[model samples]
Target chain A: MHIPFDQLKAEFKRVLLKLNFTHERADFCAQIFAENSRDGVYTHGLNRFPAFVQHIKNGLINIDAQPTLINNLGAIEQWDGNLAPGILNASFCMDRAITLAEQNGIGCVAIKNTNHWMHGGTYGWQAADAGFIGICITNSIANMVPWGGSTNALGNNPLIIALPRADGHVVLDMAISQYSKGKVLQYQSFEDELPFVGGYDGDGNLTKDPNAIIESKRLLPIGLWKGSALSMVLDMLVSALSLGKTVKQITDQGNESSASQVFIAIKPFNA
Target chain B: MHIPFDQLKAEFKRVLLKLNFTHERADFCAQIFAENSRDGVYTHGLNRFPAFVQHIKNGLINIDAQPTLINNLGAIEQWDGNLAPGILNASFCMDRAITLAEQNGIGCVAIKNTNHWMHGGTYGWQAADAGFIGICITNSIANMVPWGGSTNALGNNPLIIALPRADGHVVLDMAISQYSKGKVLQYQSFEDELPFVGGYDGDGNLTKDPNAIIESKRLLPIGLWKGSALSMVLDMLVSALSLGKTVKQITDQGNESSASQVFIAIKPFNA
Candidate 1:
C-alpha cells in the first residue's frame, strides 16, 4: 500500500508518456499526482488517475493544445486555455502571474477553456514557494444546490489562498460545499451516515444520510447562504474575468471541461 | 422607528459635525451609516452611531487625520490610515484601488491603523458600482477561538467579494464566525436560543444558548477548522501586506482602532 514517492511518480510518468504526453508534461504531471498522494489527497492522486486517462482517451483533454494570449493589461492578462491539460495551463498561468507580480507588485491571470486542475492548492504552493502571495479560484460543473433551491444549480467551487512565511507557507484551500461528492461517496461506500447534516433528504429536510443526499444531488453549501453566495460570486469573478463559460454553460455542455479560472500573485514588500 | 433615509443621514451628520468633523467627512460618514440602515444593516447604522461617536470622543478615531501613502508599487500600494475614521479611510483606499485597476486592469491597496469600516460590503458595493471586481479583507480584535484552541485567539475577520453585473451586483461579505458577537448579543438580549449551535459552553460542548456562549466567549467559526484557518491566514495576509499589526498585536493592545486591511479591485473583461 506504501510506494516510494519516486516510484509512484515514475509509474505515472510512464503511463502518461504512452498516452502521448511530452516528456516534460508527463514528468510535471507525474510529480503533481505523486505529491497530491504524498499530501494525503488520494482522491485526486492515484485513485483519480484512471479517470484522468479516460478523459484524455475521450479527447476531452487536448494535450497538444497550448494556452493562447487573449488580452494583456499591465498587471492583468487573460488567456484562452484551448482545452489543454489543466495542470499545464494552471502552471503556466501561475508562472505568468508571478512574473507579472515581480514587475508590477501584483498580477492577475485569468484563463478560459481549462480542464479540471485536480488540486488547486498546487498553484498556491507554487506561488508561496516563489515568495509571493497566491490567490486562485475555479468554477466547476454543478454539484451543489443553491441556497433554498431543491435542484443542483451551483458548483462546489474551490478557493485557494497562500502566503509565504519564513518557517513555512500558510495555505488555505477550501471548497464552497460542506461535503464534496467524493466525501459523500466515501460515506456511502461504508454504508455510514454523515456525522452531521450533509444535505437534504427526499422530504427536503436536512439529513445525515449520505445515500439520500447522493440520490437527491443536493450537497449543502458550507455556511448555508453564505457559502451559496460566495460560490456564485466566485463563479462570476472567474468566468467574467476570463470571458469564459459560466457554471450554467459548463453544466449545459455535459462535461466538466473548458472551465474558467483565475490566478493572482502579489509580491510582498519584504518576505 | 421608521426614519426617512435623508432624515437619518442628516441626524448623523448633525452629531458628527458637533464632534468637530469637517463638512466633507461628516457628510461622507453620515451617508455610509444611512446606507447601512437603508440596506437593513442597523447594527452598523443608526443603532451603532453612538459607539462610532464615542470612539471619536475618546480620541480613538482622529477625525482630522487622513490616509497617507506609505509605499507605491505601481498596481499595488501600502497606506497608513493615521488613525482616521474607518469610513473615510476605507472609502479612500477603495477609490484608489479602483483608480489603479482602471489604469492597470488590477490594483491592490493595503492599509494599517484603520478603524472599523462599519460594513465590509460597503466597499464591495463601491467597487462593483465602479465596474470592477472587488475583494477585501480586514483583521479585527480576537473574538473567536482558533481551531484546537479554547481561547479567543482569532479575530472573526471578514472577507468581502463583489462583482459587477448588468443586474444588481453580487456581493458576499462574511465573517469567519458562525454567529458574530453582535448577533449573539442580539439573541441574548431577546432571550432566544440560537437556531443552531453557535458556540461552546463552559463545559466545552457545542451549545445553542446565547448566554452560555457569551459567558464562555468561545464562538464557533463558520466551518469549524476551515474558518479558523481562514481567519488566521487573512490576518497574516492583511498584516503582512500592509506591514501592520496582527490579531495577536491588536488583541494585546486591548483596542481595535489600529487594525490592518486590504482592498483589491480588478477590471472585468466585460459584463
Candidate 2:
C-alpha cells in the first residue's frame, strides 16, 4: 500500500520491458507514471497502468511508432503521432512548439493519432520549465452528452494553461465537464453523493447522485450550455489543426486510440 | 425604440463628426456602433453613445491620434495606440494580425494605450469574416476580486474566439465575471434578482441580489476561482505582451483609457 516511489517506477518499467518496450521508452514512461502517482493523480497513474498494458497487448497502441511531420507552417506545425504512446508524443510536440516559439515568439503544434496523454498537466509543466507559456488540449472517447441531448455525444476534453513564474509556475488543468468520469467513480466507491449536481438522473433532471449519473452515463458539462459550446469548438480546433480524427470519429472506432491534440507555446516577453 | 439601422448610423456619424472625428473615422465608428445595436448589444451601442460623447468632450479620447508601430518580430507585432478610441486601434491591430497570419500561418499583435473597444466580438468577427481563426483579449479597470482575496484587484477581462465556417462563423465572446457590470445594472433596473449568484454582498457572502452586489461592487467571477485565475493570467498576458500598463496601473490612472489589448489570427489549414 505504501510502496516507495522508486519501487513503483521499477515495477512499471519491468512490466513494460517484458511487453517489448525499448529501455528508453520504459524508463521515460515509468518516470511519468511514478510522478503522476507522486502528484496524487492515482487515477491516471497506478490505477490506469493495467488498462494501459492491456490496451497495448490488445493492439490498440503501437508502442514502437514515432510521430511523423505532416506540414510545416512557419510558427505552426502539424504532425502525425503514428499511434505512439501519448506521453511520448505529447512531450515531443511540446518540445517542438517551444523550439518554434523561441524562433518566432509564439508557436503552435497539432498532432493526430496520439493516445491518452495521462495527466495533461505534464506537458504544461514541461513548457513552464522551459520558460514559456503553454496551452494544450486533447479529445477523448465520448463520455459527456451535448447540451439538451440525452445520449453521450461529446468528450470531456481537458484544457491546460501554464504560465512560468520566477517562484513557481501557475498551471490550470480542467476538463470541460463539471466532474470527470473518474471522479464519479471515486464517489461511487464511497457511496457518497456529489456536493453539487454533476449530471442528469434517469428522469432527465439534474441530480447530485453519483449512481444516477453513472447509470445515465451523462456527465454534466461545466456551466451547462457554455461548456458544451466550448467543448464543441475545442474539438473542432484540435481536429482541424491536426487534420485528424474528431470525437465522433474516435467514438465510432470503438476505442480511444488515435486521438487528436494541440500544443501551443509562447515565449514570454520578459523571457 | 425601433429606429431603422441606417438612421442610427447616420445619427452616430453626425455626432462623431461634430466631435472632430475625420469623415473616414466617423463613418467606420458609426457603422460598428450601429451594427452593435442591430445585433442586440444595445448596452455597448446606443445606450453607451452619450458616455462616448462625454469622454470625447472631456478630452479623454484623442480624436486625431493614430496607432503607431512599436516593434515587429516577424509573426508578432507591437503598437502604441496613442490613446486612440479602442475600436480603431483594435480594428487596426486585428488587420495587422490577419495580414501577418496570412503571410506566416499565425500572427500576434499587441497594443498599448487603447481605449475600450466596446463589444470585443467585433474583432473576432472581423477575423472570421476574413476566413481565419481569431483570438483576442483586453485588460480593463479593476472590477473583480481575485480568488481568496476580499478586495477587487483584477479586471473582468473579455476574451473572444472566432472560427470561420462555410455555413456561418462560430464566435464566443465572454468576460471573466459571472455577469458583467452592465448586466447587473440591467437587472437592478428591472428590480429582479440574478438568475444565479452574481457576486458578494457587503458582508462578503455570495448573493443573487443585483442591488446588493452593485453596492458591494464585488462581482463574482465565472466559475469562481477558475475565472479569477484566468482573468489574472489574461491581464498579465495582454500587459506583458504589449509592454504596457497592468490593471493596477490602469486603475490608478483613474480612468479606463490607455488599456492594453492583444489580437491573434491563424490561417486555417485548408485556407
Model number with the top lDDT: 1
Question: Per-residue CA lDDT of candidate 1, range B117-169, in tens?
Answer: 98899999999999989998999998888878878899988899998887898
lDDT of 2 by residue, B166-264 (tens): 899998887778787877887898999998888989998989999998898888876566677778888887897898999999999888888999999
DockQ of each: 0.77, 0.53
| lDDT of each residue in A159-241, candidate 1, tens digit only | 89999988989888888777777678778989999987888887789889999998987888877776788788899889999
Task: Give candidate 2 regions above 4 Å deviation.
Answer: A190-192
Q: Which predicted model would earn the best TM-score? A: 1
**Model 1 chain A weakest 10-residue run by lDDT:** A177-186
Give all candidates' CA lDDT scores.
0.90, 0.88
Q: State which docking tier applies to candidate 2.
A: medium
For model 1, the superposed segments whose C-alpha errors exceed 4 Å read: A186-194, A209-212
Which ten-residue region of model 2 chain B has the weakest summed lDDT? B221-230
Which 10 successive residues of model 2 chain A have the least lDDT summed? A221-230
